[model samples]
Target: MNGTEYRDHRLFKGTVTERGIIDYILSLDESLRLNYNAYQTIVFTVTHRKPNLFRSFIHEKQRGLSAKMDQALKTFRQSEIAIVNALSYDYSNGLVEGINNKIKIIKRTAHGYRNFSNFRNRIFIEYKLLETKTAA
Candidate 1:
């Protein structure tokens, strides 16, 4: 599987980073297979602030949150259609969303980290340790 990064400046807070993660998942070679006969279906999940700050403000100033969400949903749906047509497989954002939540929890519990490299290493070590414990 290949993982790349997606970045968008317009998105609130961690949106750019989250999109990067999704891009990474979508880049996996086997992610395109419909039946996943040769590979597994790739799932993309992301967790972001509930009531995205940008959206909240936009809604307050514009039609409403529902309208903003509807527009965003439509755009997302269109993007998914395009991606599915090109890849011949289904893509999911649920997993990515979950992972984002998990990351947030971890960060909060630990009271955050001083450096991104340290954070990355900690995450890697935690996963590796979990894998070892599970395998044992």
Candidate 2:
């Protein structure tokens, strides 16, 4: 899959959970070592904006501040490296954000979904449909 597609997948999300997203990201290239902290800062900022999700994932299992900090530090080190290499490239995190907004718009437009499966299908279908149109 393309970068955008790769970023949007639940498998990638799971990787973020399992291996830590920053580790996976840094593994993509060794040149990414310089700006790792910057990338982590952005990620931490975004996570703060979604406190519920953050709390649910990291803190729910009684994992305290120390564990969280260690994880964040490990992820940040690699992320800083990745961001350094990414500096020269004019990549927009906007695409992923835009896709998220589009998904919200879809849910709102359709008055929300009844179940997770349907929600997943709807999003997958919507993405595929948009991809087809763009390809054409």
Candidate 3:
């Protein structure tokens, strides 16, 4: 599910108290829950900012929480700086991936291309059409 759906249902984050079980889960330790909310916020944030606050908070939180939480935090701790850097990394395989997907579609649907030159021309034509479409 998407963000809103998960927050409204799975996270038990809503005004309605019809779900007593969910309420109990959240009320177990309200402060811990608040800390987790902050942690999750840091994890989900997309900006190119280093998570200095998050790194410190995780250390403090790991001391207080369970072994299960410690395990997860351990993984994050190992890649702490990398996680922060991921926020604004420009390098991506998305363009190549998109072209690969289009190439696969062309290979699957088209027939009678007996030579590699014919297949190459078809792929070039596809890119040319895409370029024109984007230019317009």
Q: By TM-score, highest first, what's the ranking?
A: 3, 2, 1
Best-to-worst lDDT order: 3, 2, 1
Instruction: State every prediction's TM-score relative to the real structure.
Output: 0.29, 0.30, 0.51
List pairs with backbone clashes in candidate 3.
Answer: none
The residue-by-residue lDDT of candidate 2 on 1-136, one tens digit each, is 1332233446564323433565678677655633454345447645455433333333333222344455764564556545443543456689999899989988888897889877877888888853323454
Which candidate tops lDDT? 3
| Model 3: lDDT of residue 105 | 93
- Candidate 1 lDDT, 1-136, residue by residue in tens: 3234545556444535664654545567433322232112122211222223323332332322344455654564556545444444356678889878877877998898999977876677766743323454
lDDT of each: 0.48, 0.56, 0.65
Best by TM-score: 3
Give the Cα error of residue 102 in candidate 2, in Å: 0.9
Per-residue lDDT of model 3, residues 41-121, tens digit only: 566554435466666755664445555666777887788777656644666778999999999999988855789987888
Which pairs clash in model 2? 32-81, 32-82, 33-81, 34-81, 35-80, 35-84, 36-79, 36-80, 36-81, 37-80
RMSD (Cα, Å) for all candidates, in order, is: 21.9, 20.1, 7.4
For TM-score, candidate 1 versus 2, the one ahead is 2
| Model 2 stretches with alpha carbons more than 4 Å out | 1-88, 129-136
C-alpha lDDT (0 to 100) for residue 54 of candidate 3: 62
